[model samples]
Target: MSDNYAASFSINQPGRDAGILPVNQPGRDTSTSEQSHTEPSANGGSTVSTRENVRPGVSYLAGRLEFEPSIASKLDALITEFRDGKSTKGNTVFEAYDFVNSFPGGTPETRKFALSEFLSTIDSVEILADAARRCGDRAQIGLNHADTTATPRIEYTANAPNDNALIQAASQIGSKRARSEALSDADVGPGRENDMDYRSGEKRAKLTTADLPWHSEALAARQDGRVSCQATQDLLYRYERDPGWVRRQVIISGVAPPTIPPGEWDAIFRGTPVNLDAVFSSVHHVLPPKEDVGRVGSTEIRFSNPEPSKRIQTANDWTTAWDDVSEATAIAFPHRARELKEYGSYIRSEFSAKMPSSHRKIILYDIAIRNFVQGGQRHLLTDFHLFSRFHSAIVAPDGVVSGSGSGTKPGSSSRGRAGGRKIDGSKSEVCHRFNDVGRTCPFSTASCRYIHSCKGCGSTGHGQRDCVQSGRDSRSTS
Candidate 1:
């Protein structure tokens, strides 16, 4: 009999579906034994069982938690009240619903909804007859039913916390400082790289070197044939000392020379040069001291406060003050070149320390002038002192300088004007004035009756507008 039973239990592939019993076989009874289903467990064990009908449970719990409640306390209270007195073991169908609710998962609202759903749908809870305790002396308070109707009427929710909220909460705990302010308070003492301002200052100084006004003036003067070696040295010295005076004397009048090259005949016919030293001496016995003629970083000079006598005490105070002015000016340029007006507004807001308006204007002008020069616009030097005024003057592409007031005189290179003189050999003229080569005269009307003399010339001038003699020479007698 044991051998027959062994033959019936034939081994097959693990997890293979149960095969149907054969209907007929040679010399065998067809319908003597009952058919059974065998299922393999993960531990290589197999269990034989018959099928039973089951009902599926509906999902109720979903979403986030809002309120906090003690699940352990509720579970203990339900277990104690719903138990039989004999062994304190046994729970009612309603107690099973409470047990499921007390189990962890889902928001407060979701759990309450699930409990209501379970109480309404569940008909009865049965403690199974085959239910047995494997371990002795162990306290078991819940229902001992093994199957519970072969399926659960209410499902337990698998709730997970929001990942984004968890990540955000983690990030907020230990934030870092901005990179610009990375220098620690310890690293910044009285003047030791204080608040990383030193880094910024160092960068500004390097940048200022490339765009200094004095450097621009030097290059322009060098191209226009004005600067000498000794003049350059004196210029540098003055820039290091009194930059304000250099501006008063020179860069304000630095206009670019004409771009076109003169023809050989045009050059030869111009003229002999005049003795300017003698002429200047005759005009004024004492020459204005040969001044520094560059503005390269000279915009840094801050004028001293108006003294009763209009002078400063020690040279040291003056030098220190000028250095401060230059440093501030350098900070504002090239970096803020495009947004100069905005930068000026920012400066006003930051200067609660009450900086002089003149100093602020000086720095702003430095930025503006550099921007103009870089944009390929010519700087038309106008006399600020003569006008005692404040205004911007437009320079035409043709190099005509026009302004609002009469006090602003555009310099001529002919009659010892602030721009100095250029000799023209074309018309036997000792003086060649600064003329816009192709520009119309700003003063001329359609018909002029005034004695129209050429600039710096007593003779009928070279151009058609002024030289009536040349006009007559060109006329035919026929």
Candidate 2:
């Protein structure tokens, strides 16, 4: 009859509980008389609890688990230490668990299938630490991951033509038959086809006439003289005593020098023969004197005794006979005929006695026939002889006038005989007939189109100094 349910049967009474219910304790007295039993809340409270099934945890089953039996048994012992290709110290704990299962959210699908299963397990770590230091003690402690075989195959062959036919029949039966009997007892030929006589003892001492003691005095001095200057100084002192014989007589007689005939200067000044008509009348008395003298016909001349002489005829004998006597004295002194034929080729080449008597020979034949007739044409004396001797230097009878030199006064002006007057104060007689024809400036007159539109900014026809649309609109509105 001790009925005090010590504050709700003290945790379902498992020990210090010797007595307790009696009010008809039948099924906890009919479940505490059907209803009311509330006294246990001082923070140690629980009424009938046992819940705990909340799963989705290890961070939600760590991305749906699987190959993690400790990283699939350290990737099956690092794919069996790379299929037994050795190196172990737990292969850096299987490469730090294969670089933390190659991250980006470790495995499942992210670590690109665990970095392609850890790069198909090895073929590197320096070839598995050089196959574990050359696989000492047959190293492979485990990793027959179901031995799927595949990697070891090598094999090569080829060099067999019966091992090069038994090394070419044992080098043709040993030491190549003693190097073919020491090259057939040293006659060593058969290969570069013979002929290396290397002067077979000086070409067998040049074959005859008592072995060459001057081959019978050079065959009796080539029968008297077609060659004798003492047999060409004993064949040029035996061709300079032989060795390479003056480069084989300068490669067989072609070294060059012999030409000779420019009229052989009369057989080179006749060391004794003279009289070819007394050497052409002593060189035609030192030459220059042949004036207008007549004939015009013959030319023969030849001589150094090869003959042909008799035809001198004369007038102007030929080779442009002093250019036909200076073109017939420049057609008969038409104004000192090219100063007397350039003073006859400068006194026939004694260069007019070395010039300066005010360079006379008629002033070097009037400056060598006025540089041989104004070299590029035009100057055959013009301006109607100073208007036929000055009719006030013929002012505008259609202008022209010219002359002023060799003894002046043909209408004055090379600045002399009180010359100055002409500028005809312009009534456009074409600017006073272009200043009486010495034309200084009617600027080619069709009234000089305002002097040809003022030649651009010396102002008129508008050359806005290279305008460019007034300089890009004055640089875009300044």
Model 2 / residue 265 / CA error / Å: 64
List, residue by residue over 322-415, the lDDT tens digit for candidate 2.
3433332232123435544544554344333432211122222333333433311122322223223332322223323322111223443332
Give the distance in Å from residue 117's predicted Cα in candidate 2 to where it truly belongs. 6.2
RMSD per model, one decimal: 30.4, 48.7
lDDT scores for all predictions? 0.28, 0.28
TM-score of each: 0.14, 0.11
- Alpha-carbon deviation at 256 in model 2, angstroms: 38
Off by over 4 Å in 1: 1-185, 189-413, 416-466, 469-471, 474-478
Model 2 clashing residue pairs (backbone): 57-60
Output the lDDT of residue 131, model 1. 13
